[model samples]
Target chain A: MLDMIIDFFVIGAKIGLILLPLILAVAYTTYAERKIIGYMQMRLGPNRVGPKGWLQPIADVIKLLMKEVVVPSGSNKALFLLAPILFIAPSFAAWAVIPFDVELALANSDVGLLYILAMTSIAVYGVIIAGWASNSKYALLGSLRSASQIISYEIAMGFALVGVLMASGSMNLGEIVKAQDGGLLHWFWIPLLPLLVIYWVSGVAETNRAPFDLPEGESEIVAGFHVEYAGISFALFFLAEYANMILISVLTTLFFFGGWLNPFQGIPFVEEVTGWIPGIAWLLLKAGFFLFLMIWLRATFPRYRYDQIMRLGWKVFIPVTVVWLMILTFMIKAGVGPWFTGRGVL
Target chain B: MTVESVVFYLFATLTLVGAIGVITMRNAVQAVLCLVLTFFSAAVLWMLLEAEFLAVTLVLVYVGAVMVLFLFVVMMLDVDYASLKAGYTKYLPLGIITALALFGGIYWVIRSEVFGVEQMPEPAKHGADYSNVTELGRLLYTDYFFAFEVAGVILLVAIVAAISLTFRGRRDRRGQSVPMQHQASKEERLRVVSMESGPRQDGQEKTEKKKRIRRKKGGGS
Candidate 1:
């Protein structure tokens, strides 16, 4: 019993540790997005807040909390209320498998990558339920569109991940990073560049970001599935979207960009200098770059037409990933690559 | 009671209650939600059995993708509560008999000496890094290759069958070509045909006047 009590305390502490940083990440992600996007548009974004909008996320949170949550008259009461919590829970829960540094993950399970994928897959439920519970036509349509979009892109994403799995020879996130410890060439991205690209696109679609964000096009659907949501409810959906983006960025770094490893590990002097920086810094640098790219893509690309986005995912992305997956399998089996050192290579 | 036992009991109860809810819920959507609940609870139980990969996959595939589709269909369905319950009494006897036969078969299998506890003992606790995924993959590839291949073929056939059944291309309908659209200049959409403006044709006007006169004459008669 005492052991169990200690176990609970340890678990709580770990969760609190992760959540504190994560919540801060989610909060600042919005600020970074606005500032970055603002610079792109040649404007100062929210400078009126605490020192160049650094504290804007906190102000927004307070404002959202102060607002009233208005449930629609015809809405399904119970499910409507449950939707936001459901959306936000899995977004944070998937963080358990993410190795911040070498021994930093809460649950360093055997199937870490798979766990992240599964947790992400389950997030669509909250969106579907939220849209359905809203009892609004626009909400229903938006949710359906978003649900189908996420599901379709997830296939391409999964195939792209198969390339990572083949290269690393393990589903464990730490093992995957460890496989790429030697250098830039050792990273899976060198050979699996196409898969990496597809993975990024899939990540964009999965989060319903710009270009693939036809589901929630403010002009068309008036903010999509969460159109009816207000106050903290709306804020939760917003947080979940950004959290998923961060999650995707982190996964991208871990899989293809060699998470927590210096960019020039093979170069003797470069490696020595860069290695002095902590592993967590490299990991953050890679993930932040991807996150910045996400915002960059949002600001650069026009919203893709609905059918066009669907066609890209199904016709283009899926087939490419599938063929690449087969090629990767053969490559691993034949032991042709220098990177296939962990297993099946001479 | 020990902690593990207590946890197991909690999961067991959740699964049982969810299963019951699946059948008893009057709303079809509610029933589908209950089914999802049951699937997830079963996954939790699988975790207790130290099959974490299987558990997560179950939650991922069944509760995530399959149940979403199920919910989509159920939500779209126009269900009448009275009509749904109408078949209950009519099928009660047959349902009871079939259920009993199924229960008896399961009972026989469980009670058989061939399938005793000695045949399949509990798995020993593994270390922190014992990957169930790798173990399962190795087993599937080596000892059960043929079975795995057969299953893959069956699933592929099912996919083909589903696509063949539903996929109908309507060539009559026009579809946009993105390149064609982009390459399209003002010349394609707008054609300039310089022509003199002619006076309005009086033929249609005369016909209209004649029809009006005839109608007036007919009304007079």
Candidate 2:
């Protein structure tokens, strides 16, 4: 009993170690987004708080925490409160199986990738509940759009991952990374380029980020589902969105760019020189790059129209992924490339 | 009780609660949420049985996609709870009889000699390295291959049927053709009608005069 109690505490500490940094990273991602977008627009962003706006997220957190949580009179109080928790919990829970190093995962389950997919799929409920519980038409409309959009993209996303599964022949995230062990060319991104693009784009749509952010269609619906949410309740939604952004970035890195594997692994002198840097650092750097790419996309493109977003998800991306999946099936069957040569029947 | 039994009971109780909530909740949205809760608890029970693939897939497919769509429809509906409740007392006797019959049927099945714990002993636990997914996959591909293919075919047919039922390719509706829009050129949209650079014509002057008179009248009003 004493040993079990100690183990529980140890696990709690480990979880805190992962989540604390993740939360901080999420906070900074907002700062990075603002600054990056600011630069693109030729303006300064939130630089008044501290040096280079280093303390901006902290200040924002304090402000949000101090504000009153104003639940609307017409809202369902139980579900209204429950929505934010549901929205945020899955983003955090999915982090458990994300392998930062060789043996640094919380739970190295065989179905880690599927677990993450399941967790992300569950997040739609948060949006739906928030919209419905608020008793607002705009909120309901926003959530309806969001739920449908997410479901549509999820199919494409699942197909894209099927390409990865065929390549690596493993559902275990750690094994998937290990399969891409030799060098940068061995990475799944090289062979599965279309799927990578589809996955990332679907991920953006899944998170309701621009240019696929018609759910919030600020001009059309005025902040969408969380319009009635205030203060900490609203902050929770904000946090969940940012956390999911980071989560997608990390997942993209893990699935395509090779999680925690050195990009210069097989290169001659560069590998020797860069080998001293830890695996976690490489993972973080790659994830950060993807995060910047997401922000860059936000700055570069206009928000997609509602119908256009749907069309892209269903007509364009789904077909592309399906075709790629068929091509992948042939390649795996014929034993063509480094990725497909030694794989057993999927 | 042991830890496993404790966990089992905890989830089992939650499952029962959620099932009860599904029937008892007044609000339609709340009732759907309770149904989701019931599904979730049952998924957890499946997880306890080491059927992780099925459990996660249940959450992913049904609780995630299907339930969200269900909630979407339920929220959109403008239900009249008062009208629904009006017939409750009128049908109470029939409802009670059906409920008791269901209860009795389930009880008889469980209490029968052929269906006791002794008849179906607990499954042996597997080691950490044993992957149920691989085992399940092998079985699915070999033994259940034809059934799986049939299921896939059925789903495809259903999808086609649904699309045929709802899809209307109305030419007169004037929906945006995105490909055409993307193909649009500056020349097509902007008619740069070239003419000699000259002073305004008599018609332009007349229009300007009319605009000025209208503006003057509006200001006076």
Candidate 3:
């Protein structure tokens, strides 16, 4: 009994350790986005706070906390408040299953990938409820757009994951990384490039980031589902969105970019030197690269028009992912994967 | 008394409560949400039974997709909650009869030892690292292959049926062709011809001259 109690406490502490870093990362992701976007656009972004606005996220948090939370009249009060929690919970909850290092996971269950998928999928409720409960037509419209957009992209995204599942043959995130052990060339992206493209694109769409951000098209729908939200309520939604972006980036890294693995394992001196650095650093570097790509895309590309977004998701990405998945299925079944056979990701 | 039993009972109670909420809730959206809660709690109960794949897929399919879709429809439909309760007392006897019949049927099944507590013993406990997904997949592929295949085919048919029923291609609707839009040229859209500011020539006499002038422009020739 005493041992079990100690085990629970240890597990709790481990979870807290992961969560604190994750929350800090989430805060800094916003800061990094501003800085990167600023650099890209050749404008000074949020540099008024601490040195280079390092404390900008903290200031933003304080501002949100100090503001008054406004619930509109003729709104479903219960669900209005509940929406942000539903949205925020799943985004952070999915982190419990993420394997940062080889043995460092909170849950580390067999179905880590599916668990993440399920949690993210449930996040749609937040938008839907928030929109409906806002009692505003604009909010309703925004939420509806978010719902359809998420559902449409989810199909393509799910198919992309099917390709990864076929390649790795394990749903455990650690196993997925293990399967991709052989540096850059042996990464799943090489074999399943089409699926990788579909996955990454759908991931951006899933998170409702720029270009695919029809749900919150500020120009048209006035911030969409979150238009009616204010103060800390809106902050929760904001945090969830950024958190999801980080999640998607990490997931992309884990699924395709070979999470936490040295990209030059075969090279003699380089591999030995690279091995000295911890695996988590490699994972963060890859995920950060993807996150940077996201901000760059946001800075460069214009928001996607609504119909075009749908057409791309339903018509283009779906067929591409499905066909690629079929090809992948055959490739895996025939034992044709050169990466899997001899070296075993080295 | 045990942890498993406690968790199981907790989930079971919540499931029942959610089901009750589903029936009693005045708002249609709230009722649908209650149904979602019921489904989720039942999934938890299934997980307690060590059916991890079954439980996760339950949440994935029913709660994630089906309920959300249901919410989409429910939220769109402008239903007055007060009207939903109007016929409640009018159909009390019929409702009671149906409820009693369902309860009786369920009780009869449970009381009979065919699939009751006596016949259905607790499944053997697996190790901490046991993966039910692999086991389930093997069983699904081998022993239950035909049934699984049939289920998939039925789902495909259902999908086709639903699409056919609901999908209406609108000829009245005009949408932009992105590829055509992208392929469009400035010359195609705008012809910057420097014709004489006034009429080039007489009505009939200018036809040939107009053609010659257009040809000289070099784009439409």
Candidate 4:
């Protein structure tokens, strides 16, 4: 019993280690987004709070905490309160299987990939419930949009992951990363480039990020589903969204860009020098790049029209993934090149 | 009790509660939500059995995808609770009889003589390296390949039939041709007609002057 308690405490501390940094990252991501977009628009962003606006997210959090949580009259009180928790819980929970470095995860579940998928899928409930329980037409419309959009893109996203699974032949995230051990060229991104792009794009759409954020289209639906949410209740939804963005970025890094695996492997002098740098650092760098790319995309593109978004997800992305999956299968069967040579085919 | 049994009992109780909630809740949306809860609890129970693949797939396919769609439709529906409840008292005896019949049938199948601890002993726990997915995959592809393919084909046929039934390609319905939009050129949008500069006709000049004077008079007024 004493040993079990100690083990429990150890796990708790490890979870804290993952979550604390994750929360900080999510907070800073909002700051970075503002600063980045501000710079892109030829203006300064929140450089007013602390040194270089370092304390903006803190202030925001405090403000949200102090504010009153106004539950609209006639709203489903239970579900209204439950929505934010539902949204944020899965976003945080999906991090358990995400390998920071080799053998550095909370639970090294064999079905890590599917677990994440299931968790993400569950997040739709939060959006739907938030929208419905708000007892507002706009919120309902937003949730409806969100529900259909997520459902459509999820198919494409699943198919893309199927390609990754075929290439790596493992549902375990660690195994997937280990499969890409040789170098940068050995990464799944090269052979499964289309799938990677699809996955990244689908990830963006899945998170309801800028271009595909029809669910919360400010002009169209006035902040969409969580419009009725206030104070910390609202803050939870915000945290979930940003955290999900980071999650997508990290998954992209893991699945395609080689999580924790050094890109400088087999590069002679560079490899020797960079070998000392820890695997977690490489993982963070790759994930950060994708995060930056997501922001860059937000700054660059206009929000897609609702029908266009659906068309892209269903007609374009789904077909592309299917075709690429077939091609990948054929390549694996024929034993083509360095990629499909010795790796687990099916 | 052991931790596993405790967890099992907790989830089993939740499953029962959710099932009860599904039947008892007046609101359609609430009922659907209860159903989702039931599905999720059932999946957790599956996880306790160490059928991790099946558990996750249940959550993914049913709770995640199917339940969301179910909730979507349920939310959209304008259910008349009064009408739904009108026959409850009238059908009470019939409902109770049907329920009893279902219970009796289930009990008969699962009773101690046929399917109990002696008949179906607990499965041996596998090692840490034992992948349930790998074993399942092997069994599925080799032993039940034909059955699995047939099931997949049936699902495909249903999907095709559903799509065909609903898809109406009406020429009247205005839809954007995205490829055509992409292929659109500046020439198609705007034609720059180069015209030689010429002196204005006396009649045209007079009309222009009259219009300008009229505007001036209107402004003055």
Candidate 5:
């Protein structure tokens, strides 16, 4: 009984560790976006509610909780209720596969990259369902646009990952990072510059960031698929979006930037000298830098026309990735890869 | 059966039931939800098979992206629930015959297997690093690299086809001109006008004033 109790507690504690940080990070991320955008646009963002809007997300939570959920009269009420769960659950679940550090991850499966991709992809349904179930025209149009955008970008993203997988020879994120551990120069980014560019662009498009953010383009569809959503329902959608952004950022770090590997390698005093900072901090820092770029892109670029977005993904990204994939294959076959060996990236 | 076997059966049953629900359900939205259940239970089954990659991919791709799109389209279609019921009786005999044939064929194939050397029983512990993902990856990029590359090219072609089929310019649609927009400078977009000209009346002045009043009213209410 004592052993069982200890096992349950350990498992429960691990579950808590995953859930608490995710929920908290998601909540704060909203505040960070608002504040950052506000600063960039030259306006004060959410300062009245709490200290520099630190507690504003908390207030938003309270408001969402207190507000009565009003289901539209002529909607598929069952799906209407379930859509939020479908959206948020997969966003949360995808976190399980992300290896924050060598030791720290919720569930370290061998197919970590595939698992994350699959979960992130499934999240689009929530947006689609929200738009459809609302029985509203704007929502439907938004969802349709989102579906096409996500599916198109996913092809580019997957191909980009093919490049990373070739370099690493492993599908496991942990193993991928381990493969990148010689130094900064040895990282996949040095040799696979094309894949890096494609991955980053596709990452922006995948997360539905600005320039590619036609789905929620405020002027076009009045908040897109979530237009009919209000209160907590809207909040769930918000959480999912930010969660997805974080997931993509982490993936970019893991696949491209030798995740958690301090760039100044062979220096014994690097991580140990900075031992006050946890390994998870390095992962977070890399992820944060990418997140900053995402926000910067949002601030910098105008939303692309729907056709233009499609053209960019299909005509440009897909072709470029395919050609590079051929080159990478040839290099790997000829033993010209950065870390040349008989083993292809597993 | 042991606990593991019992659990496997439970998940398998759930997956099959969920799949059946997906097809038979009258409500299109309900069908999509059942599909989600089907994906989830199938993932559970894949866990039993030690095929974590395929299982997780099933959840991530099918559950996350594809089904979401499916649900979205299904929900927005303005589907006439009554019209669907009208067609069901008309096609009932054809459907029944097709279903029976499918089931029979499936059972026949499942029951008929080629004789091979006696299968090795799963060891209490497999050899060090016997991961399916690793072996699969090695096999794919080495011996199957040509097929993998071809599959990629096929997907690329499919993507091009999908885009071309859907791509059409709409003059009525108000969207940003990418080249013209990208050429924008800070000076053009933001003018440091002292709050001042007291929020200058360029293009959006009247609209902004109206919005401000409406926001005030809404906030007050």
Candidate 6:
């Protein structure tokens, strides 16, 4: 009994380690996004709060927490309440599979990619429920768009990932990163260039960023699916979105950029030498790069028309990914290049 | 029973209850909700089976994508609750007879012993690797290569068929021009002509010069 109690605390602390950073990251990410977008727009953003608005996220958090959650009159009260939970749960659940470092992860399952993919896919429900439960047309429309967008993009994204899985031959993220040991050129991004590009673009679509963010196009849709959400209900959606952005970036790193692997090789104690820099920093840097790209796209491109977005995803992305998957399989079997020779190559 | 078995039974009960609710619910949307619940509980049961992959896939594919789409369509349709209730008394005897016949057949199959009730082979003594995904992949590629390839082809054909069907009944005069849309380029869409304002400036072109500068600045932003 005593041993079991001790194990419980250990397990809890382990879980807390994963959860706490994510919460903090989600908070700071909002600040980073605002600051980055602020610079892009040539405006000083959130400069009033602590030190160039560094503490602005905290103030926002406090305000959200203090605000009263107003349930709409006609909404399905039970499901309305459950929607945010459903939305938030999958975001947290997905963190379990991400290998921050080789040894540091909440749940280092062999099927880590699949698990993350599965959890992320499940996140659609939160949007759907939030849309439906609001009993509002705008909410419903937003949800419908989100469901279709995510579902379509997810298929293309999965196929793109299949190319990576084909190259690496392991869903284990640690192993995938280890395979990219030699240098950046040897990374899966080189041989699987088509996949990398497809994955990146589809990932943008998956996260509803920029041109693909038609669901929440402010001018037309009026905040899209979460239009009815306010106060803490709205805040959950906000948290989920940024967390997902982080998740997508982390996945991109693990899949393509060699998660936590030192870029320059043969340096004595490379990972150890960088003890001053935490492993989480590399992961964050990669995720931040993708996040920045997402923001940049948002700032630059106009939103895609609904039909056009669907056509691009289904017609162009899915087919291209499918063809590339076939070519990758054939190349691997036929022993075409260095990828075939090196078992260690990711 | 062990704690695991007890938990298993609880999920099993939830699954059965949800399944029953799916059939009995008068409201079509409520029926769909029950169906969603059934899918969720069934996924939980898959978790009990030690098949996390299948469980998660069930949730991801079925609950996440398929059922939500179902709900969207079902709720939007003007399903007549009165019409659903109208046939209840009239069709009761016929429905009962059909259901009884199906149940009897299922019971006969269970008792026939054609399929043994033997337990699954015990997992390897080394314990679970959680790497069953890799093993499944190896088997699919090597041992079942032909079957796997055939399945892929079938799926591809189905996708092609679905897209073709979607395009079949289009009567709109301005139907989307696939080839023309594909051929469209930025240069064609936005034309640039150079015209001197007063003197021949170094960058006198309006759109072209502006575009060149915009493109370069756009690179960083």
Q: Which structure among the candidates has the greatest lDDT?
A: 4
> For residues B1-221, what per-residue lDDT tens digits would candidate 2 score against the true structure?
55566668989999999999998898989999999989988998998899989999999988998898888788878888788889989999999999999999989888757678888888889999999899999999999999999999999999999999999888699889998999999988998778976656768888778779989889641
C-alpha local distance difference test of each model: 0.87, 0.90, 0.89, 0.93, 0.81, 0.80
Residue A79 local lDDT, model 1: 86
- lDDT for model 3 comes to 0.89
Q: Is candidate 1 or candidate 2 better by lDDT?
A: 2
State TM-scores per candidate: 0.90, 0.94, 0.91, 0.94, 0.79, 0.84
Candidate 2 segments exceeding 4 Å error: A344-346, B1-6, B166-172, B193-221
Q: Give lDDT: candidate 4, residue B39.
A: 94
What's the ranking of the predictions by lDDT, best on top? Answer: 4, 2, 3, 1, 5, 6
Among residues 3 or more apart in sequence or in different chains, the pairs in candidate 1 whose N, CA or C atoms overlap within 3 Å are none
Task: Candidate 3: list runs displaced more than 4 Å.
Answer: A1-8, A342-346, B1-6, B112-116, B193-221
- Model 6 chain A scores worst on lDDT over the 10 consecutive residues at A337-346
| Candidate 6 lDDT, A1-346, residue by residue in tens | 5665676688789889888888998899888878888898999878999888889999999999889898888998877888888888888888887888767777767777777777878888788878888888888888889889999989899898888888877877777777776655656777788888888888888777778888898888798888888889889988988888778888898898888765554456663566566666777777778878877877788889898888888999889988888888777777655555643333
User: Which pairs of residues collide in model 2?
Assistant: none
Candidate order by decreasing DockQ: 4, 2, 1, 5, 3, 6
Expressed as tens digits, the lDDT of each residue in B1-221 for candidate 1 is: 55677778888898999999998887777788788878888888888778888999998899878998998998887778787678988999999999999998998888757578887777698886677888899999999999999999999999999999998989787888777888999987999999866644768788677779989889641
lDDT of 5 by residue, B26-127 (tens): 887888788888888989887777777678777867776667667666765787777768887889999999999999888876553522234444535444
Q: Tell me how candidate 6 scores on lDDT.
A: 0.80
User: In candidate 1 chain B, what residue range of length 10 has the lowest lDDT sum?
Assistant: B196-205
lDDT for A201 in candidate 5 is: 91
List, residue by residue over A64-127, the lDDT tens digit for candidate 4.
Answer: 9999999999999999999999999999999999999999888899999999999999999999
Model 5 regions more than 4 Å off: A1-9, A267-277, A333-346, B1-10, B57-95, B111-128, B137-221
Error of 2 at A22 (Å): 0.9
Q: lDDT tens digits, residues A178-293, model 5?
A: 99886677678876888899889988887778989899989989888888777888888888888888878888888888898877665677746665666688889999998888
List native contact recovery per candidate, as a fraction of 1: 0.56, 0.67, 0.42, 0.72, 0.81, 0.50
Report how far off residue B78 is in candidate 6 (Å): 1.7
